[model samples]
Target chain A: MTSEHAPIIEMRNIEKHFGSVIALAGVSVDVFPGECHCLLGDNGAGKSTFIKTMSGVHKPTAGEIMFEGKPMHFADPRDAISAGIATVHQHLAMIPLMSVSRNFFMGNEPVKKVGPLKLFDHDYANNVTMEEMRKMGINLRGPDQAVGTLSGGERQTVAIARAVHFGAKVLILDEPTSALGVRQTANVLATIDKVRKQGIAVVFITHNVRHALAVGDRFTVLNRGKTLGTAQRGQITPEELQDMMAGGQEMVALEGSLGGTV
Target chain B: MTDTAQTPEQDERVKEISSFRKALIRPELGGICGTVIVFLFFAIFAGNSGMFNSQGVLNWSTVSAQFMIIAVGACLLMIAGEFDLSVGSMIGFAGMMIAIFSVSLGWPVWLAIILAFLICMSIGALNGYIVIKTGLPSFIVTLAFLFILRGFTIFIPQQLENRTIIGGIADAAEGDWLAPLFGGQVGGWFFEFLGERGLIEVFERGTRAGEPVVDGIPMLIIWALVLVAFGHFLLTRTQFGNWIFAAGGDAEAARNSGVPVNAVKIKMFIMTAFCATVFATCQVMEFGSAAADRGILKEFEAIIAVVIGGALLTGGYGSVIGAALGALIFGVVQQGLFFTGVESSLFRVFLGVILLLAVILNTYIRRLITGER
Candidate 1:
């Protein structure tokens, strides 16, 4: 998947600042179509800021974002969405009390007109929601089931299926599996595999090394708001990637403090 | 039966049963039960006192109708996750505006009514704007409006007429084309027939030539039913209704999905104020006068009714029908108390108890559905 086709999105020296604090300093990464480009980083390592800039949550102080080989600027998340970029935040942005179908079509609902009145087409929304979730291998009991009753992995799957059904070209998922258990993590990784197969570019951001190694086609690591390097799968081992994510010098210092015991 | 031996009909029946069970746990179910219990209590205790008679029923229905008008609006606003404490004050202010414009300023009654609605809606919009712009809870913002509007209601009348009471509104509206639409009664012939046939008790006093004076269904009751139907439709069926649910459930999530939460809340506030004005207009036309204290404490009553209807105070869940039923319960208890020789002040205690019980029941039902505890 690497270098076989032109990159779908290319970021060059993206910098973001909040007054005197630098959230992202000269960080760059590229994602290709049908590839799970894992953004590997620890907390405060600028991974979130980078993802935010890419998804149009924030404007970069200095940088250029080329989407599909053309310069792109997004005023907000809606602008990014209209341009075929969708983001599923770490919080998931779902109303737990609402029905699954309602959550699936929250901001964009289907409507039918009767006489002079326009109404939410519940049948259409329910049928499409169930069908889309089924495509991701989730057999929902019913579209009217409250989302709050769903497991964490199922919720993440719903978000992924929603992004895909909405025609998202590049899906940016921020730390999707950080709060899930082992089996749930596997489910999310499997969903990512299904998404990748659909030729939609997926930027899977996470701090978990094993989860990334399981499904990522390529990995770009950030340390203290700066990119350490980008590596293709099989080019870098999981241990090497983990040490790099923790900062190579810090890992060395911790190892020395332990006296290389056992 | 073995797992694979079940027929499609059995599967369909299982689904139907489960769905029916799901419906049973809905928030409105509590309100429905409460309505039935209150009706039964009044029927058993106050039945012989004419509380169940046609005239007595009409009396309570009219009162409930007034409360329902504001309760439906409050229910919608609550569903959208906000409050309008200024609703009671808005009613007084709107009535004052209609009185001043129609009687004092000698304007046409219909024109005055329209202007009053527009002005009240603007104030409602302002309440919404301040809450959203300042990121303040609507409770605090509308609380401020409650006092501000109440003060104006009194001060404005004193400034213009040197009195707190405005009169002659009924006279101004008497022959107006819009008077019947907002102010008169229906079903007079039917009620007259009932009275003549001795099916309904004719009033001994306040009668004209041995005929019952209260011979029709008050227009307020009709307006309430219409508003309830409309509100229910808007909350459950429309796209805007979905937005209301989304906005109330989680404003940030709704906004992230491209629902304009701010606009929706503002519109809800405007509708609430519009409903208050409608109530005020009809009352003034019926009574021929408006007082500065016309709707004092009405805000709490509307909220109480809405809560009884099964809407969570925290927002995101409710039904307009439930609120209407809550209003009916309120009317029954209020008039029933009088008929049963209970002190009217006990009505306050009844409201307090019912509100607490409804809140507790609503929370319990929600937890049951969410499987929280």
Candidate 2:
């Protein structure tokens, strides 16, 4: 797939530093259209910093980002969003007390002109929300139902469906399944597969190698703010990927010191 | 396929919601129930006390209108996840400013009113700015302003005229263009004609006879109704209303989604100040004077009315209609106790009880929404 398709987003040697701490040291990843690119790393291995830089939450201290073959700089998250790069964060960016339709159109509400006043078009918003959620394979009770009432997977689906509907050419999902149950995680993986089939580039960030392999086309491993390697789906085994995630040689040394299997 | 077919049955999301549960989810549920219960109690206890008469109705409605004005502002601000404890002080300060400008400085009544609004709203904006910039809770910031503004309300007039209370505003504003809007009556001719037709009671043994007991509706009630309508429309229909809910429900999430949470909160703060000024303007016009103690404890009253109207203390999840109903309940109960020959001080007891019930109801509703036990 990588051989035949051009990368939609190319992060070339991206590095981000916070005063004295180096969060990302020249890390690079490429996302091609219609493919799931998994970024696997243990906790504190620069996964968050790398994605934040890629999604424009932080400016890269060094290195360039090429979007559709053109060098681009995102001033903020909004800039990246307008350029069709949407990031579904770990926190999900949803108002739980609000209705599904309202959350769907939180910032970009559709309005209809009634005399001199511009009113939120509830009918349009409701129909669109229902239809979009239906297409995502989650049948909502009603558009007016609160987001908090939905299961974790359904909420994650709502967030993903929202990003895809809003013209996200490249979707960056950050630890979406971290808080989900086993069934919920499978649902999320299925949703990811559906999203990839729609020809949108997906950057799926996770620490679980099994979850990554379930839907990912390519795997990129990061350790201690540096990339260990990138491999095609068939080239990397689960145990090999898990070993790399645990800092390979470092895990071996820890096991020897403990004199027991971990 | 089996899983998909079984989802509607196994999952609670698609299950049929009970009608009782549905009714409990309404933001106005508590307020409507309280209003109905209060009205019924008053009707039975004060049946022949003329509490439902035209004059008595006017009295309670006017009082309710005052609460509605401030509660509308508080409702919107609470929905946007902030509090303005300085509302009571703002009312007193605004009235003092208007009196000082119009009565003492010989300024036109209209200009004085506008200037007071400007000053109060600027202070409101400053409150919001400090909260947003400093990342401080609005409760602390507005609490500080509450004392500061109250102190100034007393200090300013005392320094200017060697007294805290100022009079002569009615005489100064007699012919001013804007005085009529704040201190005027409407539909007087209709009431007078009704009195002439023997449809209503008239002044019988006085110097003037055949005058209706209720002449016309006061502008205060009119202002309350208009503000309620406008606030309801803004909360339910506009895009800004959605932003208000999002800002309150999850500000960080709203910000990430580009809702401009700070701007919404600041604008809501200005709105509260605007409401407080309106309240003050109407009070001064009606009383014909301004006093430092005019609006003491009014801020708490407004908050209580809003809370009883089903607005959560933590912000988000409220309605303007609910707030109006809560205000209506306050008006009826405060006036009803006097009509029923009960101790007027018992009104505070009613407020405390009702507030507790409303909070409990709101918590239950929140649990239902969040699907928590």
Candidate 3:
């Protein structure tokens, strides 16, 4: 239903090459407002390269990025971030030893001026951090608790909540559930669902078909630096998506050769 | 997992830590504990030795102020994930620069001090630049500078005056406008009043009879307190302080989060250099000369103080107050040994033992926070 609205972000014919390696060959993806667009791929299927280009970590060798109907060029990730594109990487980009509130506002800290000195507003930061965490449904023991003490799922939630609080319009999550347990994965997927309902476009990249299908409204599969296809929810089945992620016909030929040998 | 949806006050997952455990995780716990133990030991063993008397207290306090100066710099730099092995050398070099300019070259004393600061801080900036550009470890980069600066300290004096020691700096600096800020003492009248009331010891048999033996506080001690207070406030209350922690904690993560890691590191290096120069100026003013080897091994002493203050060798976590306490311990122990009729050389052995114990404590605290075995 949201597809009736124009895409909040659009990429056209994006190509990236790294010294004789074609990491992304004219790959493109469009994320709509209030949609979870899952980018599904196998280990070396160019998903990482594609998202890196989208988030301004890498300049596309050839392509144009349209952000909200205007042609855009990002000089660096900081530029992309200021434009409301936030990437929560596989490592989560969080310092584990810092307090939760500190990590919550790493770059964009809140300060209150006392006389001539500008001080970090601890009361405001703590209140906002706790309130945001509560909204994400993860109750912290305290804002001062180190992020390292939190579970993996809770850390992901912190990353997500930080992005949302900072007013990120496009949240790019790279393999967020790859290292999580079953229960944790469910929590993250639920968090994703909650985030999407807030009208932010989420670019969720992962290899797990089940996790992708759990919350994704639109799915795009990349194989060997090329888009295999894009499908809306209810237009594709789990087995078909899994087969595509496994390189579809390539898996069939490998099995044939194995069968002949047996 | 879904239990997170419950109100935080009623949530079982939000397990409140016991106050004891909470206190144990503080970065200053080890330093505070070490301070208490050392003071108690000194009181028990050196009580009658007058080690706690007015003049005796001033002696150890002045020495502690020296360590406190450099430890403030080292603590901040270490927390920012870099090492400056050239700090001691910078001190020697800076003092030598001031001596050469003021005593030999006939420059005004204030100008010499300002020039020395500029030159040393530039070297600090260069250290940061090379480390950042080459992606080399700061340990190696600063180690190289350690030798380079020390070499200059010796080479410059020898070439200028045919001697590695320069004198007449105090004479040249006498009555200079900026010299008093570093070398002067304060509160003379208060001490005189104390002596008049017999609250403090007074000279008994010299031309200075009836005057308090300990007249006033030295500027070095004041500088140390100011630096510590400034560092504590900066680390705890400012945005730049948070950036320092982030830059040291994880450079990649901090960069990804939009922190200017390189700039923060460079600023920290410059700060380290500034602290070293302050130390050198104060020392040169007090002693009336500069020698090439004056600050030998002071770099390691500063680092040891910072580590003993409960900072991790890996960086990102520390406290300036803790480092100040560590310096206080060093001063008390170094002076206490002499007062107690013990071998002063035993101080080195104590340092070794205490350093090992501090590392053990820091590791334990690290595990406590990280929940690692």
Evaluated at residue A197, the lDDT of candidate 3 is 93
Model 3 interface RMSD, one decimal: 3.3
lDDT of 1 by residue, B2-111 (tens): 11211232233323436667778887877888788888888888889988777788888988999899999999999899999999999999999999999889999999
Each model's number of backbone clashes? 0, 0, 0
What candidate 3 gets wrong by more than 4 Å, as runs, is A253-262, B1-15
TM-score of the second chain, cand. 2: 0.95
Decide which is better by lDDT, 1 or 2. Answer: 2
Sort the predicted structures by TM-score, highest score first: 3, 2, 1
Q: Give the poorly placed runs of model 1, Cα more than 4 Å off.
A: A2-4, A255-262, B1-20, B193-207, B210-213
Give DockQ for candidates 1 onward, in order. Answer: 0.37, 0.52, 0.51
Task: Summarize candidate 2's per-residue lDDT along B1-373 as a digit string, tens digits.
Answer: 1122123423453678888877667878888788888999999999899899888899999999999999999999999999999999999999999999998898999999999999999999999999999999999999999999999999999999989999999998888899878888899999899889987777897776778999999999999999999999999899999999999998988877778899999999999999999999999999999999988988988988998898878887888999999899998999999999899899889877877887788667776775544
Q: Which pairs of residues clash in candidate 1, taking residues 3 or more apart in a chain or in different chains?
A: none
Cα error, candidate 3, residue B14 (Å): 5.4
Chain B of model 1: TM-score? 0.92
What is model 1's DockQ versus the real complex? 0.37
Best by DockQ: 2
True contacts recovered per prediction: 0.49, 0.54, 0.52
